[model samples]
Target chain A: MLHRGRIQAQGEDLEESESWAADTPPTWQEGIAMIDKLENKIPKKEADLRREAFEKARSFVTQAGENGGVNAVVQKTIMVKDSKEARVDIEVRKGKAFI
Target chain B: MVQHLFKDFLKNKRIYAENVGYWQSIVSELFAPTQIKAEAYLQTTFANGEPFLDGNPIFHFVVKKLNKAVRIVQEVAESDKLEITAWISNTELDEMEINELVIVLQLSEESKTIALDLIRTWILNDETVKNTKLKIKEINLTEEILAH
Candidate 1:
């Protein structure tokens, strides 16, 4: 036992901690409210991109609906990529209604 | 004959279906770019559990139709990013007769806050869709609503 106690650790704990330290109890409701508030701030540019992608998807579905046949299952899938290169995929189909 | 029925179904329900799915998908795709997980649910319930009226079915066919539409939209949203997955569901609320749709998304700690803020803004600012309102509620990890 070579005087290990005399040689103490010197470096600080720098690794990122996964746990969050809060003084008070974290309520589920509060966490949800916080998330809601954050989502509401999505940039206008991003919103517009999403809207455009949605419209394109709608158009595809409409066209498929327009051309329908008996016992026919119309299926259409489309992919939209935004300026950031994020891709969105949409798939639609119609057939016998089920409960 | 079947084609005619579907055509009529789509024509009568087109605008509603389009608006509902479009708005939900737009939000889904936007968040997808950030590798956040997002999903939308379109549900219908009959008032007082009454039978389907001549004007509207007890369970309006549109809800299911829109679910499929949203699925397609999610598919497109995923092409841009590998971090998002979207799901849609239909639930029958006993003795209730109102059509309800909800879009719920899961994101990283950083992205979660951003998404919540955007939804709050939309709820306060956007009123173009008639009789539609946006609400944000928490999902308990232990009590998951995604399966439903």
Candidate 2:
């Protein structure tokens, strides 16, 4: 019978244990710290994107669609789709279900 | 002279009328892509609420927020009235396109509702419709914020 204690006693087990240590994700507290680091840069990034989006949206609404007249939007519907192929693929796979 | 004044009034009325309908459609659907299902995602994967904001797909290539998309999600959890502000644009590979997006939602409802408001704010702020009144009493979803 292969005893579990015998494996742990082996010198090779030391290397296996080291590898296991390397595989661990950050600790919960460390993870929170990582999240904080990632989050710190988020606002500025998103703000820039927001500004660009506003410009794009405004241009589309005015120059591209001016013929419809402002009142023309009454009948229009809003459908959001990613222009990037990768993003579109993600949406298609996820089917708009969050997570 | 009276005819000229009438024409001016009609033009103004037409602009406001058009905006009114656009706002209605916006509020009706409200937070779309981030439907009620988002709450589940937040609870499970995204820092319990801190999903970065910039990665949202409401904007395509010009803005990428993949690794940092949880900030906005976390902000909503921390507060009640936070604004997202993004664009919902679509074009035919730099050809024909449409970028009309208007949204209104009660931030205090759910994650989906909050996301809807944030993204909608960006769409609603389009310069073309910026001058129009944003409220009509016909269907007051929230207070009187409806775009007129």
Candidate 3:
């Protein structure tokens, strides 16, 4: 599965490559139109996968937000240990502490 | 730097040290999520009657607002990325809030250093400051399991 910025260890690359090929630098309006077309063209399964990924990202953030006080929630990265496991790293704004 | 800027601004305005805590409390409270409305609690003056410091007051106001919004999201979602589409203000208010905050908070050397460091961390961490985007990647499955 081709994830946000990385190629997942799966046969997802073929479809992802095709989508990437279809993508071109677009003007503002063209960009909007392109997004519309892409949204329409994407397979339901692929769309579901993307939505799941987005939700996962959102969940990590939500958890950080709940726990973090004034600190801002940053990024979370998951390192896959194997097909059934991974490690999640979360970054948050520590803010400047004045002594 | 914020402290210095605030101190200098206060000095210039001839505000008394007795009032410093009050102002700080105001700033901090404004940033609190529970503070839905922040009315001017009190406005007393020093004997000198120097014009209120040129910038810090308003700057504090805006920062407090942003902080409040951030706090609100943090309280509600716990771990969700926040994309604040609209708040109580428009683009003009947003721009002014950010600009004033940068200028006022950057005025004092200490405040500048602190603000810069905070800003650097915010950027490096991919966290939003005033009006930017933020993304949180998922935790690895192993870490989640371990935590449990």
DockQ of each: 0.02, 0.02, 0.02
lDDT of each: 0.27, 0.24, 0.27
Model 2, B1-148: lDDT tens digits are 0011111222354643443344334444653544221111111112223311211221211112111111121111222332222223231111223332323222233324444444344433322333212321112333324222
Worst 10 residues of 1 chain A by lDDT: A2-11
List the candidate 2 regions with Cα displacement exceeding 4 Å: A1-99, B1-55, B58-76, B84-94, B100-148
Query: Candidate 2 DockQ category?
Result: incorrect
- Tens digits of per-residue lDDT for model 3 on A1-49? 1111111211123122111111222122332333344334556554444
- The TM-score of candidate 1 is 0.20
Candidate 2, residues A3-98: lDDT per residue as tens digits?
A: 000001001111110000222222223322322333233445332333333333333223212232121001111112221110101111111111
Better of 2 and 3 by DockQ: 2
Worst ten in a row by lDDT for model 1 chain B? B51-60
- Model 2 reproduces what portion of true contacts? 0.00
Q: Which ten residues in a row have the lowest lDDT in candidate 2 chain A?
A: A1-10
